[model samples]
Target chain A: MGALPELSVDIGGLKIKNPVIAASGTFGYGDELAPFYDPSLLGAIIVKGLSLRPMPGNPPPRIVETPCGLLNAIGLANIGIEAFVGEKLPSLATIKAPIITNIYGHTIEDYAEMARRIEGVKGIAAVEVNISCPNVEQGGMAFGRDPDSAARVADRVVENTTKPVIVKLTPNVTDIGLIAKAVEAAGAQSISVTNTFLGMAVDVATRRPKLANMVGGLSGPAIKPMALYLVHEVVKAVRIPVIGLGGIMDYHDALEFLLVGARAIQVGTANLVNPKAAIEIVNGLTDFCLREKIKDINEIIGALETKGEDHEKKGDRKDKSKANF
Target chain B: MDKSRYPMVEEVVSIGFNREIGKDTFLMGFPCVALTSRAKPGQFLMIQVDRQAKDPLLRRPFSIHGVLDSNRLMILYKVVGKGTALLSALREGDTISAIGPLGNGFTLPGPGERALLVAGGMGIAPLFFLTQVLTRAQNHSVKMFLGFPTSQDVVLIDQLKGLGVDLSLTTEDGSLGIKGLVTDLWDQTLSQESTQKPVTYACGPASMLKEIAQKAIARNLRCYVCLEGYMGCGLGICQGCAAKAAGSKDKPYYYVCQDGPVFSAEMIDWEVM
Candidate 1:
């Protein structure tokens, strides 16, 4: 009846027009994707991972399709930080969306240098610290293993960059809550819960791994439920915002993350399936708000209500376990 | 090429013809004016055949085989897996969602220069369109060498035969023209040619392309090779179809969908790639 729902979201101070941001790696430097639709229409665009210097990434057969998931060991392939600021940034300036460049490094200085270079960029909304790449020899999953290393990596990037820092955590960790708290303490403005899960698929015919890197990060619809759980877990553990991702295909999937406690959602593997998936989700969210007669889309964020019966069942289960002991 | 000038079109196109052309190979023609008119030889389309299903969530990538007219386009394919098998089952008039005129097409050989095209199996699809494009120029001398497993797997011979170019075919089992690989015929053609170092264009399996590359290198000739991989989004954003381009000192991985499904033969470091 009125105009429409407010789709704008501020993830721990990084403001975007909507809650639908294109996930890194899936959406390049917002160049190839521009033909499908104007990326500025999206909430934000996270460019491919970047290092201090240009990295060649892994060998061929880097991406393999399996079931509902995609295994990619792109090994943080990028043109380096200097090239981005020099060449790619000028082109990305045309898009109206906020740009959040994803940075990965082998050492803390590597991360700081990338962030420091990105700090002066005009259009960048924030810097997403990638500490979950499983394909690389140094950094990646190794940094996310311990809380201290993860915190230090986060602290270093934040110290160098004037813009807000969003740490993207890995799903391989045992306690994602502890890692979330660690990054928060290190001044990470926000955390994107659950990067791709480390998984390996083998070809029966070849008797070798699907990805040349031996293992790759798994993203797509298969990991959505697990990613959602991690997002909710981190949401309860930290005061900062949580950007939920991993396997989000449509608006309903995005809505679930928002209701469970995510401030915003990202579409990763779905981009491979549908080039316009992120923008389509943005449109779908608007349609959902219109149908539900909600004024602000943010009202749906962390709105999960606990029924008394469900709480009683949880209490009863705990009491029964104690009684048996 | 500015890709936006081609204009991407996604619509349900009616199939004009769908029939078995060769062993495991079929040609499906659809009528879509917007896409057919703008499509170049090497460009591909992402077709969604099983519209009702989600298990095969991503659309299948098919290179533009040949343009029938301003309103119709053909996609020639072989049934390799679940996606193509699904594509083969469609009958005439069945509508499929297609996104196209995507990716940069092949760079045509210069005028007065001789052109050599080598293709294997279903890889003949794009080369067929390229032959027609080259013929229209009416200046360059065109020669084609196609390879198939046997006589049964051979396809589009009649169409290629009428093109007025020097066309040849080969089969592995000696059921066709020559009793060896297409490269054998290519070698023979080069040995007894009067044309001054003709540029070569090719499409086929990896092994065949590698073989062709070695032959091209031995002769010190430049070749353009079109490659295919497990592509997710043919739009290049996915970075799924990445082919390692051998740079001078910094060998960077180029997105095959973006940088090229078609590239200079020597640019790709086949050994490590």
Candidate 2:
């Protein structure tokens, strides 16, 4: 009977209608899912990572399914910056949601050049620096593994583009918190915690690695819990907003990240599982808020009740739940 | 390429029937009017075997086997892995999610042209559907050569015969028609044919298809092949199913999910594939 819950969220300075974002690579260049649903319904859309030149990606047998997970070595195959801006951006710009361009490079200069090319592009609202692609041989996860290199990639992108810079971190690191702090200190406005975890599978009969790249990134429900812990760690380490993503298949998973203080959440492999996943999460979040009688979705952000909390507050929460239901 | 002909639908439809036709092979049909009405012969479906389980995280791709009553879509699949094993366990009335008429289908033979369908093992899934379409056309003649490992692996013998096509069967064990591969029949069949405009459509193992592609190219015959690969998203998004492009300088790979589950044999680098 009251107004709908407020779902809009601000990822640093970039504002979106909700907190469910379509992760890069999973949601092609924003056109692939048009048949399933209107992409503008999501908080934002991150197109596949683009480089200075078109990438052919890895050879066939690039993906294999594991227990509750998917191992993919797509090798960052994309249509390049020029093709995207010229071919995809015009149509994508028509959508109401903010379009964030995910960029990666093989070198520091390649990263800076990609940032410069899309700097004044009219449709692009933000730039997500992918310092964390595990499948690439050169600059991808190499830059993300070291704190100083991660900061430099962020600093260069921030310098090249006026758009808000979001440094996406790789989970295949010793201390993710240190990398988060370094990128935040380097002037990145926001950070998306956790790209796919490095993993691989093998065919026992053939004794051959499942992926052509030998090792690929593991994603899906198998990585959700670990991703949540990493997101929580990054949130505690950085002052900038954190976008949580790993194995976010539903709204419950999205809420886990938000409770840990992630500003938004990206639906990656889940999109491959179900193209309507992000939109479904958006609907689920609204239903959750309405059921709980929460006025704004942000009220639950970082509202996790840890151990040793006041007994009186815990009692009040129980009493409120009993009365609301 | 009129997009309207191939309308992609993502729906959760209930299974109409699931029957085992041969060893480790099952023919399952679901009543999806949206898919059955528009699905072409060589096109396929991405079926989520178990909607509630996550171990088999991704959907399994199946070629459109046939249509029943103009509303039911059927899939002929073998239990080669976990996904198909789970699909085989699914019974009538159970529900599953599927996305289809996903990729391009076979290009139908024109009037006065002869249709030659070559299927090896489970490759018969799509080619069988093509045979059904080809036989229905007034002026076209359909000749099918199907090869399986043994007699027990062969399926749809009566049904295929009911269609009244010139069907030849071959089994490696010599338990069915011939003791040799299906390509052995190619020389005899092609030499006996009087039609100069015979288009070849094949689906099966890469090695088998490569041999057929080579023979077709040598004879200057028009050939199209239906390809299969492990796919993440049946839509072109994941880029997981990359097939080497033939002699393409600018683009090195063709996404099997989008470009062609069905392609002209000449378009693929047969040696690498």
Candidate 3:
């Protein structure tokens, strides 16, 4: 096979070697995935959620496995932004791929503070605002749930740093389109959609909640369809690029995201099963493009739109209809 | 320190699903792991609970308990969280991913002196292998001080005793052993000792380890405390498990995944623990 054609793409100010990047939290700082696989192959690695101060995160047990999905109530445990610059960022400078940091805050100032502090870091490519965090009080869900609040945060960060800001939208909202449009209108260089849906798990024996926090954001294969729908909606709503993510495990799913108008794709829960999920998806996409006689793989981007809304709905129904449980 | 050996899972048996541990903790009972790499007293194994299972993404870590030979290693762990919980639900014949004999185990045989091993809760797991190595090393005399919450909480005691080292016990309710915390017994033994340093090794709750570190300092005896930290990557990359070492105060901190899940008493930040 003629060494899968170089699948490079640039989104916002970031230059990705390929269109595949490991979603935040799943690829903890770049080094965790370094030992198992090479980091150079990835488009970029989004580090776990970072805060202004060190957070202990939710009390244990923090994770649960649902069929084809996972529920994590880690509560954004991180070493804080200062530590990221002091310890983590310096280390990532050695890797070839661009490094994207995901920032979470309880207030607008926290988001600005993180962006200001991380400005001009040597290896950082951009900042992805994680507006969907439901566990926190001041930040997280408060900002992402509403288009206005989400845009405000995105705008503040845009002014705070020169680095391209990608606003990550929440799928728990009634209309992800409005939120996507709001962030884009606020001058966001790019928008990444569908940060885990609000979910809860129960103990069958005790009739109690499984996660100590009671409710958590759900991700993995189970949330892919929702992710795709949001990605599709957001792509149409915004003219700027969109980074699509949610339960994306394999290349085929990633191809679907590209067809739905995602300029880039983030591999989230799939990294849990395989640390090399993003690299594999890139390789798979390359292979698929080559097999389909596609000269420019970018042609596949937004390919699903050609089917029209009705055709896409029918396709989704047929796929879900065959799904066993 | 270096991953001289990559991890490979030898077996996976799901004893059952445990709701109390978590909604997902599979009580994956692995009969054996490949121990050829030689994990000392405090080393650990990074276990991928179910190779084929997809929901729980990252590999869960466990402390290595016993190494029978180059071909077989044993880990003693409770079903906690999605990784282990899912692991515990597997059938008799299943394969899981295990990478290990990682981390530097405790230094052994302190100048031909007698040693005492103290464990609290699941902390007792790693010392199982430590005892065997100590007994076999000429000139090193070993004893074990084990504690659990209740009778059913007790495990590996008979196995430890069968190794023919001196043994004592403690329980919170005094069900089957000495009453009170394991530290109580450790304090009693240390307060009275003067000439015999009795190098100590302990594992368990962070609070207990902190107390043990304090007692080790107070008693002027050498001690190694195995630590526990939340991890995203069992390897040192995540920075999720970075911990402050007691003596390294002037310096930054150490990564538990890499620097140590095991650190010398003086080396660990007992206060934070």
Candidate 4:
């Protein structure tokens, strides 16, 4: 009868109703999915990737289904940052949850321009820097792949935007912990680890690629294990909160991230499969807390039990991540 | 005006029937109230083949074929790939975890307007549902042009024949009614029939729709089309089904799953799409 459980959390100082955010690219500005359920019911919503100018995106067959996952080479298709701030921000204002806009660019300047433009925007609680889209031909994963380049992009956005900045990291890099440390040192308020892995699929009979572009970012449950390791390493390497995402399907997956030290979790590919997934995760997490007699969801954060025999294994892993840092 | 349409509804509905209507093509019926009651023509449903499968993680999107009652409807699908093949294994009385009535439906004809429905291959699903909406209207002058590769490739004839429409069927191999492409039949209709320049509504291969859009543009006729694309989410989130805007220099793309499964003929940019 009473309030079930406290599920809200703050990321880089932005308060959310819960710890489940609809990840960028999966929740298209929240306007389309708003019909199915009030997106405000979730912790927050991150709109799709936007740039300085509107992108026409890649050609047809942008997405192809892989075993337990999807490969997409959409090339960061979006209404430019100006159109989004001008046309889309107003509608999202009426919603109760914080709106985190996902911004991408072909260059560091592009990221800073978008950041500067949205600096004083009323509704957007934070700006998520997407420097890790592997599908695009240029500028997306380029910056995130190198520590120096990632630091430059993060520093530019951090300096330009008064609103908090969450750098969205890609898993395609060799050592994500390096990029996390670089961004954190550059003053990024928080980190969203990780983005999709670069992969491709083809129809062997026709001798044609499944997607129009030869390669794309792979997402879904297939990449979760790899993503969990990356998140855990990044959480261990950096002091900033890690917003975990990359095939989080349900509350159990969300719980996994929180336990691994993610301040919150973003529902990405799962939103494509189920529009209400973020809300379901929020509701399910409350149910889990109720059943377990846990009153505070914060207790679940970094709750991974690494006792006795497991200490050596996790400690060795930490040492490796430290080397990357 | 129609029953209030919902963009997304999830339910495990019992398949009242599942059978082959044509070669490698089948129809499955589901009696789910949440969908059928609010269903509109041109809307689609995403059938999750194996909820446990990850490779083909996305649901196979199927257009609503027809509304049988307040709680029953059917999905017409062709077994082309992995998802549909997984769907084909289901039998009558089996339960399907599906979500629908997604996307913007076909805009119904006005009081004074006559309807022209063009379909190609399995794209006939949404148009077939439009015929049902037209059948119940006062202005019932519905002309249909259905195109298939050959006679053996055709389906939905017996059911469509019952609609009392001015039906025209075409096959590329001359194995059926008029010979040549479906566009040939459309050209013939334009030149032959003189029914106050009927408003055109088409759902089919991109080529056929483009042909109609071009012809509609030349003749100055109102046209609407439903486009099919490889989609991740039948909902608009993935942007996987983005259609290149045709004939426009300003805006370049339209989200096919949301902005339209149905679009005005001239509004799309065909050159790049």
Candidate 5:
């Protein structure tokens, strides 16, 4: 009977209408999903990762399906930053929602240059520095695996551009909390916790790897639990907002991430499986708020309860397990 | 690549029938007037086999096999992997989510030009629809060459026979019309006919398509081939299905889901495919 629950949220200073974002790589250049649903319905649209020059990507067999997961070695294929700004940004800027440009590079200079190129772009709301793509051989996961390099990449992007910088992190690291804190200190506005995990698959009959690159980045529901734990740790470690994403398929999965102190959530592989997934989650969040009689969706963010003694002991047990590692 | 030409439809359509036409192959039909009315010959459908499970995370892509009764759309698929095996178990009256009329279909042949339809094994799926369209047009003489691994693999014979085209069949083990690859029949057709302006349209394995493309190029013929690739989203968003472009150094890849499932043979680089 009352007005619809307010779903708007802020990722650092970049304000979006909702918390459900279409992750990079899965949602192309914001035009692919236009046939399925309106692109402006979501909180933000992040195009595929771009580079200094057009990248041809890896060879055939770039993707393979695993058990409730997908392994892809696409190698950060894009039409370069110039092409995106010239060809794609014009149409994308017309959309109502914020458009975030996702950029990756083969070097620190490449990352800084990419930030400089999109500096005063009219349509772009933010820049997501991809220092965590495991598919590429250089400058991708290489920059995110260590605290020093991750902070350096984040610091350079922050210095080159006035746009809000959200450094996306990799899960294939020794201590994700340490890297999260490092980037926050280096002037990143927010952090998107966890990119695809490094994985591989083999064909038994041919005795060959399923992917041409031999190893690829694993995503989808298979990595949800691990990604959620990593998001929880990063949210606790840093004061900046955290965007949680890993195999988030539906509104229930989105709720799981938001409850764990994430300011927003990204739907990656789910976008590939179902084109209208982000919109559906947005609708689901509204319905959930209406049914629960919540005034605003922010009431649900970081609202997880850990008051019971049993929960505290379980946290202690996890801490002990981490010490064992 | 001009997506506005064919507006995509995502719907939950009920299955009209799901039956086996041959060994490990199926012919499934669903009443989807939206798809049947807008779909072209070479466009494809991304069908979600199991909506409840996440094991097969992505939808499986199948070429639009044919249309029946002007309301029902068909998909001819062979059981080769886990996805196909799951699809084979689906029965009549059950609902499956599908998005379609996706990708660019085969370009229609010009008037008075002879249409050469080639199929290898299960590659006959889309060409069957092309044959139907071509046969109904005026001044378009249609000739088909179908090749299978064995007689057991041969399918749609009774239906294809009713289409009223000059059809030839071949098998590797000599279990059918002639014992040889389908290219041999194609070669004979090309060598035997010199007067008619022939346009080639083919779908099949890479090796077969490459051979046909090479021969068609040598004769300076306008040839179009429908290709298959492992796709995450049949909507060009995934960019998973990358195919090499012919003589192109600047832009090296063409996504099979967008640039084509059907492409001019001259547009692709055969050496790297």
Candidate 6:
């Protein structure tokens, strides 16, 4: 009741400062956005997806535009796991908040190798296994689409690393809940819902695809509704904590996911549009909870229940009448 | 990294509505920009266009076309994608976000130095400002070779002429000037001025830049080429604008956002380009 309690939330065993994590590929390593925004303000940072070896990523035209969204096929162009530990990790240790590394690989071996390397790095609070990279021919969307593949990939990573594993799920799948359950069953500490949507943009003039890879993963505001639906469904299906992200541009949008049962949220495409998005969300959440007289932000996490409602609960909910047939 | 040095757009002043400069080019003007960093020739601004636009959510990077410094700045961009297309429809007083004086600017030679300015299509945007700088210096002998698909694509020709530089025109179909890419004219020009060590400056498509770099290297001339890549933050954080470069001692892959959008021809890892 006093100042919205603390904004702190626990993911795995790691206690994040807040519920706002800079979504993968948006914040880059902590140092990139350091000039524009204060890095210590966020709960955690999920760096760009890293693989076993360096990836040049896709050819040019790797990005295209859609309504209120973007499609990118960067193919996880990173300095590889070795450089991240050797060069990037040391820089991360300086930041005050926990750093969550997002790992992506081409094969099970690739994931295992990266997991082993990152497990020992200091300041890496947890690891988010990205099984939904569609640009790569193998290991990415291939593992994420099927429950067994997703479980096996998650299991291999959890086996190799002592660090907490939060398997990121892809919305492109038919059953996101099934994938979340599989990931949790495979020993994933938490589940991060929704990577990017498999979408394409055409030049219309040349009658050719906008991206060099022909099709790219779509993110940003356009995918918000779908991401929220997936997060709601996953939180209901899984016992483990769920980190929701997709077109989370403002605090209210993030609150929607929290009310629907997301333990925390990641700001992916929004970081690209506004560098100050993550900071604003953190401040806004604190302000909202304070104004509403709600003490733990966690109190709202997954508060939605379908059980037979009491009369007092019905009176508290104004929208319940709108739902009345 | 100087925190205070970063240039943030003070305000989005001018919204250019459907102001198409060329068939593929669009113009976005900002009446006010925070001049935190001094912009020189070849430097650029990472323009976040239509933050409110739903599709094409990312910002588009553009070379600093010209900055008046009174209370506003103008960016000459081509509508190559959704970002710029949305920018083209902006209004005069509407605000647009921009981060700038980004990437390294073009390196000019000493006074009275002879230099060849080569540009293709919209690549000419950055070079136009470079021309203004060079002509204002009046120390360098400047000659410009501009190439286009056809005569119609020859934008900024009259503008370049007004700058009072030795300008030559080329189009593929021989509609306006010479035929073929800008390098073709450079090849012939280099043959005549073979004796003088002319500093080469160019901005164009990757293919065009590669060919120009090859020709410059073959002639053993010092050249700086403006390279374009997909950008995220425009401020070096995204690492999305990364390009490989041979380092002096330790680091090899240099970030285009930090190290350069303009690099010495020999320093580039040509294979990647």
| Per-model TM-score on C-alpha atoms | 0.93, 0.96, 0.78, 0.90, 0.96, 0.87
What pairs collide in candidate 2? none
Q: What DockQ does every candidate get?
A: 0.44, 0.65, 0.21, 0.53, 0.58, 0.37
Better of 1 and 2 by TM-score: 2
> 3 or 4, which is superior by DockQ?
4
* TM-score quality measure for candidate 5: 0.96
How is the predicted docking of candidate 4 categorized under the CAPRI scheme?
medium
Residue-by-residue lDDT tens digits, candidate 6, A91-152: 77767888888998888888888888887877788999999988888788899999998999
lDDT score, candidate 1, position A197? 90
- Cα-based lDDT at residue A34, candidate 6: 70
Q: Give each prediction's root-mean-square deviation over alpha carbons.
A: 5.3, 2.3, 5.8, 5.1, 4.4, 4.2
In terms of docking quality, how is candidate 1 classified? Answer: acceptable
Over B117-205, each residue of candidate 6 has an lDDT whose tens digit, in order, gives: 99888888888888888898888899998888887676776777888999988888988887676788887998998778899899998
- Please report how far candidate 2 places residue A33 from its true position, in Å: 0.6
State which candidate, 2 or 4, has the greater TM-score: 2
Clashing residue pairs for model 5: none
Q: Predictions ranked by lDDT, top down?
A: 5, 2, 4, 1, 6, 3
Per-residue alpha-carbon lDDT of candidate 4 for residues B1-273, written as tens digits (9 for 90 to 100): 111344467777888888888999998887888889778999888878655566567887889999886778999998888878878888887777788787889888888688889999887999999998898785758889899999998998888888777788989998988887877777778777665878888998888889889888888988999988788988877889878887565667787777788999988877665
Candidate No. with top lDDT: 5
How high is the lDDT of residue A18 in model 5?
93
List, residue by residue over A93-132, the lDDT tens digit for candidate 5: 6578788999998989999999999998889999999989
RMSD of 2: 2.3
DockQ, candidate no. 1:
0.44
Give the candidate number with the greatest DockQ: 2
Instruction: For model 6, give the interface RMSD.
Output: 3.7
lDDT of 2 by residue, A136-182 (tens): 99999999999999999999999999999999999999899999999
Deviation from native of the Cα of residue A36 in model 2, angstroms:
1.2
